[model samples]
Every structure is written in structure tokens, then in C-alpha cells.
Target: MISELIANAVVHGSAGLDEPIFLWFEGSSECLRIEVRDSSAEPPTVRPVEPEDESGRGLWLINELALTWGHGPRDDGPGKRVWVSIAPAHMGLL
Candidate 1:
């Protein structure tokens, strides 16, 4: 999940924005939290796709598959950061 979001942030989020993209990951016994910050004020929006569309399903899949996900302004920039958290499927697995 973290990898996917971060990749999306780098490929799509920062496109033409020339902004720094930062990734933070933290985990506890219960869950993992991942955040990706990019230099774009505009947030990532999940839009509808056509039937024959061959791409554009990254963030959409994340939103649908993640336990919870959101995007907001970064603390030190004009861009935004996207965050997602998912509960551990098994205790002490990692």
C-alpha cells in the first residue's frame, strides 16, 4: 500500500508541479500508517473511467482497498500529503 501510494505521488501527484515528494511510514502493533507528501496544492481526485480505459486506476484502487485514506495540506509547503492506514491482519507478523 505504501509503495503504491508513493509511486502514485511521484508519477501523478508531482507531475509538472516540480514539488518535493516526501514519504513517511510508521507502524505499531495494531496498524500501519503511510503518508506521501507532494508539492501540489490540488488534491488527488478519483474520477470515473471509461470502459476501454487501459490505465488511471492507481489511487482509485488505493481508496477502494485501503482501510482509510485521505489527503490534506502539508505542514511546511503549499502542496498536499496523502495518508492511509490499515490494520494489521495478524499480530506480530512483521
Candidate 2:
């Protein structure tokens, strides 16, 4: 999940240049929240998958597995933050 978020930020949020992005994690023993911030304000979408498609499933996977997920404008800057929450059981941390 973390990898998917980061990769999406790199692939979708950046404009082919080496740009900075932000990642955040917050929570306690029961649940964890993850956020990825990038320079693009566009929110991610779960694209329709073709049976033979080899990729484009990142958001779809997040949607299916995350307890909750969403995005909003970044508080500190331009672009946006994509976030997800998962229970400890989901990560085997319980």
C-alpha cells in the first residue's frame, strides 16, 4: 500500500522532473493512517481495468484494502494529499 501510494505520486504527480513529495504516517496501536503529498492537485482515480492490462491497479488496490481513503488540498502548499487508513490487523501489526 505504501509503495503504491509513493509510486503513484512519482508517476502521476510529478512532471517528469526530479521533484519533491511528502509522505506522512499517523496513528496508534489500533489503526494507522498514511498520506502522500505531491505537487499536483489532481486526485487519483481508479481506472477501469482490462483483463489484459498489466498495470494501473494501484488506486484500485488501495480502495479495496484500505479501511478508508481520500484526498484533499494540502494545507501547507499547492497540490494535494492522498490518504488511507488501515487497522493493525491489516498490516499484521496486531
Candidate 3:
């Protein structure tokens, strides 16, 4: 989930090679939350899949695997933070 979010930030966000990407992970025995921060104000959205499409399935995969997911403005600076939370039932696989 975290990897997908980071890839989305790199591919879709305005993150440059020199820019830093921040990752946050918070979890207990029950649930886990993952956040990826990049230097783009544009929010991430799930793109519609086409029948012959060879790519663009990251968000869709996240939607299927995560209990919940979303994005919002960065707290410290410009850009957006995309996040996902996994429910307790799925934590054991981590």
C-alpha cells in the first residue's frame, strides 16, 4: 500500500528527483495507517481503467486492498499527503 502511494506521488505529483518524499507509518495490533507526502498540491484520484490499458492501476489496487484511503494538503508546506489505513483483520499479513 505504501509503495503504491509513493509510486503515485512520483508519477503523478510534482515531486522532483531532488525533492524529498516523506512516509509515515502508524499501527498497533489492530490497524495500520500509511501516508506518503510529496511536493504537489494536486490531489490524487483513481483513474478509470480502460480495457486495453497497460497501466494506471495503482489507485485501484489501493482501493481494493485498503480499508480506507484519502489525500489532503500537507501540514508543513506545499503538496499533498496520500494515505491508507488497513483494518485489524488484515494486519497479520503485514
The TM-scores, one per candidate, come to 0.79, 0.90, 0.88
Q: Write the per-residue lDDT of candidate 3 for residues 45-91, one digit (tens) a residue.
A: 78899989998889999988898899999998989899999986764
lDDT of 2 by residue, 1-94 (tens): 9999999999998755766888999999788899999989888999988889999999999999998999999999888999999997875666
Report backbone clashes per prediction: 0, 0, 0
> What is the C-alpha lDDT profile of model 1 across 1-94, one tens digit per residue?
7777777787777846556788898888788888998877778888787878987777777777777889999898777889988775632345
lDDT order, best first, reads 2, 3, 1
Runs off by more than 4 Å, candidate 1: 15-18, 90-94
lDDT of each: 0.79, 0.90, 0.86
With a 3 Å backbone cut-off (N, CA, C), the pairs that clash in candidate 2 are none
- Model 3 regions lying over 4 Å from their true place: 90-94
Clashes of 3: 0
Superposition error at 54 for model 3 (Å): 1.3
How much is 5 displaced in model 1, in angstroms? 1.7
Q: What TM-score should be assigned to candidate 1? A: 0.79
